[model samples]
Target chain A: MMDSPPGVADLLGVLAYAELTAFLRFAEDATRHAPSLTDRAALGGLAAAEYAHFQLLRDRISSLGVDPEEAMTPFAGPLDEWHAQTAPGDWLETLMKAYVGTGIALDFYREAATRVDDETRDLVEEVLADEGRSQFAVERVSVAIKEDPRQSGRLALWARRLVGEALSQGQHVALARPELATLLVPAGDDITRMFARLTEAHGRRMAALGLPSRP
Target chain B: MMDSPPGVADLLGVLAYAELTAFLRFAEDATRHAPSLTDRAALGGLAAAEYAHFQLLRDRISSLGVDPEEAMTPFAGPLDEWHAQTAPGDWLETLMKAYVGTGIALDFYREAATRVDDETRDLVEEVLADEGRSQFAVERVSVAIKEDPRQSGRLALWARRLVGEALSQGQHVALARPELATLLVPAGDDITRMFARLTEAHGRRMAALGLPSRP
Candidate 1:
């Protein structure tokens, strides 16, 4: 049996842990930060979706003869720290964080997905697919911005901080796990170019919510 | 369109809130108290399952011409209070709470399911059905007790407290919502008999985990 690439396992491990923490944080935020029972249910549904993705990545890691937990442990600290630093203070900030943070991470993973084996690429793409739930964040945030235009500046800054913390933590993870970094920035590709693409997509997302992309 | 019984919406509302809170608490406990990544993922999956049930109950309430949020709001306090009073202290306590607490709630819902309309009964049965995730708790708690038999007393006391708190909050809910109470205790049926059944099932669950059912 031909073994999968080592970097593939590392990539899957990082993604699995991301999904797991996303599940936990989203659920936590929904309970503590949601403005209403309706919004709470919506965010809880999003959390469940993240958990589903976590399960898929976990099974794939195990299939590769890797212990899922062992594969996930190395990335936990950076991910947990990112969450600690970007913890939202209210429902709007929670929505903004979910939108900005998930958008960037999914963009990074989608880029990395292109470098993996066909099966792994397909799995990554499936997990990263936007299920339209992010639309909830967009609609809610847009309405909030429309009602109070002054809030836009603060939310925009919040989005920028989210991306900043994510990138800072991303750098830490990349430095610590060169193999996973290689998965994202392939042999001939520029790391800055990959980040540029992520930033561009993030700009469009921020605009969609009627917020400035940069501080 | 034939409207469902007044009590049916109340019943569904209470259940929707319960499942929503279950999702929140399970996810919170898993993140804060899980001993290992594997256990965390297992509890996260259980939380997702509870969220799925919450969606079902929420949708049912909406279809009945009720606002899901309003329907869920009334039961929030009692359920939240129940959780506040029984917050687990450690990983073992967390597991015990999941196993014992969920067991009694499911038992109570199962009894109340019989008192609803046929369609509602089916939905209730489906939501309350054990998906075997509780076995994770049973196995983990049983092994922990075997490894250190002295821990059994503490865990048993914890389980008893979980039931006591659940019953107390449950009484608060029932008294506050007589329509919901009547759904659980029909005019001819004895409320004590229903409690007896729930207690019996709780004992069986406790025994299966190799812990004494009573303090």
Candidate 2:
């Protein structure tokens, strides 16, 4: 296959694991009743969609000719704790996780996708289309919060934590994949600007989602 | 608007509630990490996906002109208890829940889709596509188990509990949604056959996984 920088594989591995875990969790946890059968069905259906997207990532990894299992073996622990440590405090908080985390991850992946060749880039685009609903899911939660002013402040805080925890674990991910980040460096410049751009973009996402921009 | 027979809404409500609760619990519990950053990301991603699916269902309900909040209110309890009673012992057991329980739910949803209206039928079909990577995750753990014969029996027993707990919850769903079950009666058939078919399907799934078919 095509070649990229040293840690691009690690980035892909992390992305692949994210999709897999999300697929499993969505299938397992989305069982409770809603007011309507249609609502219930929709919930279950969306959960299933995530699973398919996850499979795409898995396929992408194996197609790259590296064993996904080996790539996924190393980064599993810290990522999991960040999630547990920042588990949603309630239903609304859960929605915020999707609204905030998936949205942010999508942004990051879009940037990472630009650094790769046609094959990997296409995989990234395919996932982007697949995640269309994820963005809508986030938007819907924002609408709900908008409808009820009481919900705004609470969800904002939740969104902030989602950002903070993400950035924290993200530090670990960066340290682990320095070469992946190196792909972002200009021909003669240092890597500082790459992260600065990522942070600036994250700030835009927060603003778009109606949260305050990070200092 | 098309209407479900008496109590069908309640049954659907319970199922929806269960979905929501399952989303919450799995999201919370799966994040319990054991030092692997890869594991952490995998688990977190899974939780985020579940939350997204939960939003889909919630939005679908609102689209139907029903308030999702009101619809989801009824299913928060008994379903919660069922999950509590059936909680997995560890990561492997958790994966088994994905394999055994979700595998069966997908089957039931597939069969049930035939009885619903076209829109609902399409939704079910869409959801079925999402079961994509779950089997692979489960398969990964299964491969690990067979590598060590001693691990087999533990997983085997775990499989039994997963199936058992599911059967118990499935009954609650069936009893609660007698309308849907009645709708499945072929307009003149014995209901027992329907239950038998469900059980039989569950049996095949278990056997396929090398987990003993339920007694």
Candidate 3:
């Protein structure tokens, strides 16, 4: 055993917990918004994908000789608080949150995966792969906003709040787990530069959703 | 092209919705009761399995040229009501609900799978195949009851109530969709006999959990 890296377990644990929580949140939103059985099934399918990702990360953590629970426990507070602070008010808001929030998180994971061991990096890249289900959210949200242009302002505000809260939690996690942060940014890399890239990507996703880039 | 069978869509719809709701309910229970990270991860994996089953059925429904939403509409009321009526109160109750409820639902789907076409039947059998995740429930519940034998009486009562409500919903489903019932039982096959077999299996499962068979 090469002693695993300083933040391998922590990163895996955080990602695993994130997927599990995303599964629950998506399941909840499906129940709340699935206007038809088809929509519900689609949302259910998306949630299942999240759970599958959670399993992969969890197994990877276990294989590293760390208790998956112990690994995930440290990140639960920040993740749960992020969800609490950014809870969606309705169906469209839920979709926006899932789309914007997932996009940013996956981007962060992709960036962080570059700094870890090949095995861990491969696992992270695999989990970060998009399943195209978010297309459903994008199409639906775009159509809904187009139909009622007035709703755009409110949804835009909601998306901004989601991004703000997510970034706050990301910073909180980075501060609480210095080793994990170091793994994410590496020894010579700039955390501030990485944050800028994440934010720029977030803005592009917002533009795709027809929402304004700034909060 | 031979038109789809009278009840094939209905049957697929019912199973599809059942899996979706089961996914949601399981996700909810996992959030509520998982005492440890491992337990929570186990529940998440189980929920993922249900969602996988949901996708299989939903895709089948689409292949038959019927809109999956319209196909799933008729059974939503009964399934939702069954869940509402049997909502779990705590961690133990949540585990009991997941174990007993999922066991019975799978049994019903298994029996009904017999009456459908080979392709559909195969899908049903595939989904019904146990991934051994329920073992997590059985072990936990059995150990808990063994530790505090006095709690057995109340938990047993809860199990009976679950069965009763499930049966009631089963009856409601049968009455509302005669085509579905006809497909489930076929000619000369006794529905009562099917119910007996289901209950017999349910009893065996209860016994496996150290609960009295009579309950």
B97: Cα error in model 2, Å: 4.3
Better of 2 and 3 by TM-score: 3
Alpha carbon lDDT at A209, candidate 3: 73
Report the lDDT tens digits of candidate 1 across residue range A105-160: 77877787778888888888787675576778878888898889999999999999
Worst 10 residues of 2 chain B by lDDT: B32-41
lDDT tens per residue, model 1, B1-215 = 05576678878888889889999999999999998899999988888888888888888888888898888888889899989999888999998888887787688778877777877888888876765767788888988998999999988889888888887787788778887777788788866677777878888988887777897
lDDT-wise, the better of 1 and 3 is: 1
lDDT (Cα, tens digit) per residue for candidate 2, span A1-215: 35756665677778876765555444433443233334434444555565566567667777778777677665666566666776655556655666566676687778778777677788788878766666655676677768886877777667767777777777777677777656645467655565566667766766776766543
Comparison by DockQ, 1 against 3, better one: 1
TM-score for chain B considered on its own, for each of the candidates: 0.95, 0.81, 0.94
The digit string of per-residue lDDT tens for model 2 on B91-113 reads 76666665665666577666666
Candidate 1 segments whose C-alpha is farther than 4 A from its true place: B1-3
- Model 2, stretches more than 4 Å misplaced? A21-51, A130-161, B1-81, B91-181, B184-215
Ranking by TM-score: 1, 3, 2
Candidate 1's DockQ? 0.90
Q: What is the per-residue lDDT of model 3 for residues A1-215, given as tens digits with 9 covering 90 to 100?
A: 25677888988989989989999888887888777766776677778888888888888888898888898999999999988898777888888887887788789788877788888888887876764767788788999999999989998888888878888888888889998888888678877788888888988988887788784
